[model samples]
Target: MVKEAGLGAMEKPNHKHVADSDLISPAKKAKKSEEAGCDTEDPKIPSGAEDEKQEISGGEEAIAAVGDRAAEEESSSCVSEEKKGFLIEAAAAEDRGGRQTMEDVWVVLPDASLDFPGKLRCAHFAIYDGHGGRLAAEYAKKHLHLNVLTAGLPRELMDVKVAKKAILEGGWKDGATAVCVWIVDQKVFVANIGDAKAVLARSSSASELGNHTEASCNPLKAIVLTREHKAIYPQERSRIQKSGGAVSSNGRLQGRLEVSRAFGDRQFKKFGVTATPDIHAFELTERENFMILGCDGLWEVFGTSDAVGFVQKLLKEGLSVSTISRRLVKEAAKERHCKDNCTAIVIVFKRE
Candidate 1:
């Protein structure tokens, strides 16, 4: 029975603002990395200089849901252990580091059952990094997920059209990069833009976090789930040049913004910055131990494998999920001297 990360209710604001989605992208909303003062390309981004906005934004709502973790941990229902084992626990943490403003926002939705009224099990997590400003990041942290819900998220399968449409309809301003995850039953869907990234800790063999000896034999494998959209990539460069934008030698759009895609920056909209997200869906299996979502600042100091190993060691030592996330931020800001806002989310699959 693991403690789940449910920061609070997925409360929508009273205001009807028909706008926003960041922290991640596609043509849906290319969340440009803004936290590293650039795009997710920097970790120093979501990549480049302070002039380059690096924003990580995350907002999640449950279009569907199953049961909560506390209930599962305390229940004696007929649900088999194998079925119960798929329930998830999550947590998030943040650090400002040396940045003048903290521009990363994130959300955790353990079960959307209360809002959606469903028997299906679902969970969501997201993170955002803002570059020029934090407004864009903050906005996405509240509305993007709700928009996805309203757009009709498919329960049995991921309707790319439906999901992508949700993001497309989600209007945004300013700039930020996003990374998000939605879990429905055993299916996992990941959506992202910029440098904010999602990584999965997988194992070739069943390795209990409680058993280091066994865990060592079946070391967790780090699998990066998001792709960074910067001005330097050939694909992005092609688009930028076609859009009449130039990628300077330093690898920034117009010698100013480094991320080729973003939520806002209407100024760059004509130049190639977009907010569309790259979405992926896959099955969750016993081989997956946990997942991680982080803004560029955190990645600036931690490699995917290094982060997985660190979290695995701590899980074996029985550290709290919140603590693990906090440590990730603190380590990046204090120990590794990351120069931007650091934010992270940790989601662990129940193995019991």
Candidate 2:
């Protein structure tokens, strides 16, 4: 695991637009549209599309009707995406008895060439490690991308340091930990917030496909961003004790909670940098292949390097990427009969 000194307190992202609660209503949509300028209902204007109407004479009645229709379309589109490869797999076996809910999110961006060229076209991947509850993990999955985008495109490429700064200052939860990876230009930028890890698995040789036995896969030179917030690191322990907390017999703090850097644990924020994410960025080499973004659930079963190897074997055996991810959780639960939720996300990088 990577280790580092405290980077100090990170400012929370602005939630001025997001309401205190979760529920979203259709009426809210119409009001927003009306504010944006949807006045006229000209036939020549595109139907079922957002049109800039010059003037709308109708009052609440017309706005409500238009908004209701838009809301229905939006809801339908959401359901369709959920049905696709956007998989949310959870083996309830573990979550039943533990504090971990195993709520994680993953998004795969399709390779588009307008932005970059060459073999660099790659998929984006992320994994959030939540503890104390699934709130942090869930929050990270939902907002980590917005943090990166807001961080300002890292200029010619993704800057992990800048992204991490954005995350810390970007308004993610107080104790949540996150790891995100995306491809920019011809290079791969991987950033971590807490303990969640990202690893690249490379195939031995596709050109010599005829001779390789079982297709060897190895962990490529990679970067670890989010460091574990634990007592093993002297500085972390110091930060914890200084902040009025004590180390536990289990090597974790206070009988629970590992790693000192997290996004949303308000309790730990009093200790300063002990509660922020450590962001690291690195460019990948040709040997760098598929990458894995997983939580402590999978790590509980496999080492960072070993997990990558297991995934490689699964792929060689013709297991689908999603299947391998699900199996990672399944096998982990089966091995230890764990009550901690097991979750994982795997990204397979292919040449374009």
Q: Candidate 1: where are CA atoms >4 Å away?
A: 1-84, 156-174, 207-213
Which TM-score value belongs to model 1?
Answer: 0.73
Candidate 1 local Cα displacement, residue 315, angstroms: 0.8
Q: How far is 258's C-alpha from truth in model 1 (Å)?
A: 0.8
Q: How do the residues 1-352 of candidate 1 rate in per-residue lDDT, one tens digit apiece?
A: 3223222222221110111232222122434322211112111111111111222232221110001011111011011112345657677776666654445666777764337644456566877666654455666766667766664665545454454445434433344677778776676777776767788776666545434446755557677766777789897899889999898887877776677666665667788776666665556666677888887777888888888888887777777777777777677877899876677888887666
Candidate 2, residue 301: the lDDT equals 61
Off by over 4 Å in 2: 1-123, 155-168, 202-214, 217-226, 241-245, 248-256
RMSD of every prediction: 11.2, 18.2
Candidates' C-alpha lDDT: 0.59, 0.41
The per-residue C-alpha lDDT of model 1 at residue 13 equals: 19
